[model samples]
Target: MKITHYLYNAFLIESGDKKLAVDPGGLMFYYFRFSPLIPKSEWNNVTHIFVTHGDPDHYWHADRMAAVSKAPVICNKTMVQEIDGKYLLLGPRDKGVAFTTEFKNHHKLSVDETIEVDGVTITGIKTTHGPLTVKLGPFSKTLNPGRDERIGWGAIGFKIQLDGKTLVNLGDTLLHKDEWESIDSPDVLMIPIGGNAVHNTMDIPEALQAIRIMKPKLVIPCHYNCPAFFSKNFNHADEDEFRNELEAMDIQYAILHKGDSIHV
Candidate 1:
């Protein structure tokens, strides 16, 4: 199996004759001028695409890529209702915030369901997208007039099993102790280490704690340091800090930059 990173959370997974793409959306947010990341022309081999949520940065290029690759898009049910053939894609949002964008074609999957696409068996795991806020341009403002608000959207993680190996992709999520009970130990674990202090996702310490619980043989950090529009300050998670933590716990991990590929 070979995994290639493309900017933010977008990734290309190649195994034998199958190529799968995860979260192809990049730089589509209204705040950014344009996506710094561009889809490669060679994506013709993609057979399946997985989208963890409806965030623009995660699903922006999904329809475009699917059109070229002729791949089936697997996403949550809300995302399925958001597409009309290929032009307008809509997703459930808080009042005043409607569907985000339109796409060409899409297939929706539900949480806890296992589906086989091409040769891969993927199981959707439950996850939370943290509190929701009213999105305004590049910034988000709390919606509640006076009281603190807790907003959550339907988000999910994935456990992809193929070729006798299991790889887990935990989309944007906070470290929830219950998730450990739902997922089996995987061969490779792709986790987000950027949203730590922000509370939107796991930080370095929380991710390390997750690693200890999941005990995957290999760990890859993702969903951090992409376009400036998505994050005000962008920097790859402190890899050295991660490395030291891994050393103390005796965990093995690999850090890949955009456009880098790993073969396993």
Candidate 2:
């Protein structure tokens, strides 16, 4: 299997003649004015689209990708509503057109539920978004917890099995031990280490602990390094500490830059 990172969490996975796109959203910090990290033409052959959450940066451009590839979108219950959907509407738009999300077929899965397309198996692993924190200039406050997946776009992870390889993408979320217990050891684990004061996803230490528990063969970190102009709580720290720990434990890993691809 081949993996390509396209900024943020957008990843393109190629296996044989099939291609799968995960979290195909924008580089939101750039005000959504620039081109996608991965070009539209590259996505023309996508066979499946998986959205981890409904944030603009996550699913903002899923419709576009789906339209180009004519692929089936697999997402949470909120996106599977199947009714006419409303969206932030990426790219230039005409006034009063009522931008909405529509797909020929949407495969919705709840936590722990698994679906198979062709020969690949896709499972909706448990996940949670960060707490709702209201930031006030130099000060910040936490309003509510983020464990509400019942609300639909609450967030979720995915375990993709193809060609005897297993890869898990733990969207934007904290370490949920209970849910993690359900996930078997994966060949590649994509976790978010960009923990913030508001406690969105696991931080360096927390992510390390998760690594110890899940025990994946290859670990690729995500959810960090939001451009200063694009965020307030994001930490742009280097991965030396993370690497040192992983190296100490002799865990296989790779640090992927935008547009970089690796075989697993």
Candidate 3:
């Protein structure tokens, strides 16, 4: 299998004829102009799309990609709402919390729920998105995910079983040791390590703790050192130290920059 990393938790996993896209998002900050995380060149060939949450950096291009690729999108049930018999999806570019986009081919799953589609087995893993605070000079605003909020709405993790291998992706979430203890070693574990500076996901140490619990064979750290607002490295991490520690534990690790890939 070939796994490609696009900054911010976005990935393209390819095995056989399947081209799966995880969090095919774009840059969240409107002020800065940047290219799409998962470039458009691959959109038409994507076989399936998996969304972990509704964050812009994680979901901005989902609608467009699905429209172009005609791929089935798998996400949390809360992201879609049945209105007048039409299943409207949470708008990726809408102003606030609005279910405006429509995706005809989609599947929704709740925490701990499992579903099979086209020979692929997917299980929803429990996850909790932390409160995110954005600051600009003296003005600051905080958004929290809740029953009526959209900041971190429809948050979930995915345990995908395909090609006789298990891959786990924990999209921007805080550590859930008790809930994730049952998850045995997976071939690949895509985790976030930028929570300290942004207070939105697991930090390096917290991610390390999760690594120990999950015991994944190969670990790929993400959601750090990204471009947001006016900073090029908004969510910084000490990857060198992280690699050293993981290596000390005899764990395999890969630090993929944007546009990098690994084969396993």
For each candidate, what TM-score against the reference?
A: 0.82, 0.84, 0.97
> How would you encode candidate 1's per-residue C-alpha lDDT over 1-264 as one tens digit per residue?
998887667788888888888887766343645452436575688888888865666765666777788788777765543335443444322232345554455556677888887678988877776542444478766433212221333367889998989999887777877757656569889998876444567888888888877888988898766555455444347778888898888877888877898888
* Candidate 3 per-residue lDDT over residues 1-264, each given as its tens digit: 999999999999999999999999888683665458998998999999999999889898898999999999999999999998899999997867899999979999998999998778999999889998888889889888887887888999999999999999999899999999999999999999988878899999999999999999999999999988877787789899889989999999889999999999
Clashes of 3: 0
List, residue by residue over 1-264, the lDDT tens digit for candidate 2: 899987667889999988989888766546335346567878899999888876656776788788888888887664443234433332212112222545665677888889897677998888877764535489766644333432215377899999889999988887787668766679999988877554667788888888888899999987676532246335454588888889998998888877788998
Q: Give the TM-score of candidate 2.
A: 0.84
Model 1 TM-score is 0.82
For lDDT, candidate 1 versus 3, the one ahead is: 3
Can you list the residue pairs that collide in candidate 3? none
Candidate 1 Cα errors over 4 Å, as ranges: 28-31, 36-38, 82-106, 132-153, 230-232
lDDT of each: 0.70, 0.72, 0.91
Top-down lDDT ranking: 3, 2, 1
Off by over 4 Å in 3: none
Q: What's the lDDT of the predicted structure labeled candidate 2? A: 0.72
lDDT, candidate 1, residue 214? 84
Worst 10 residues of 1 by lDDT: 143-152
- Residues forming the 10-long window of minimal summed lDDT in candidate 3: 27-36
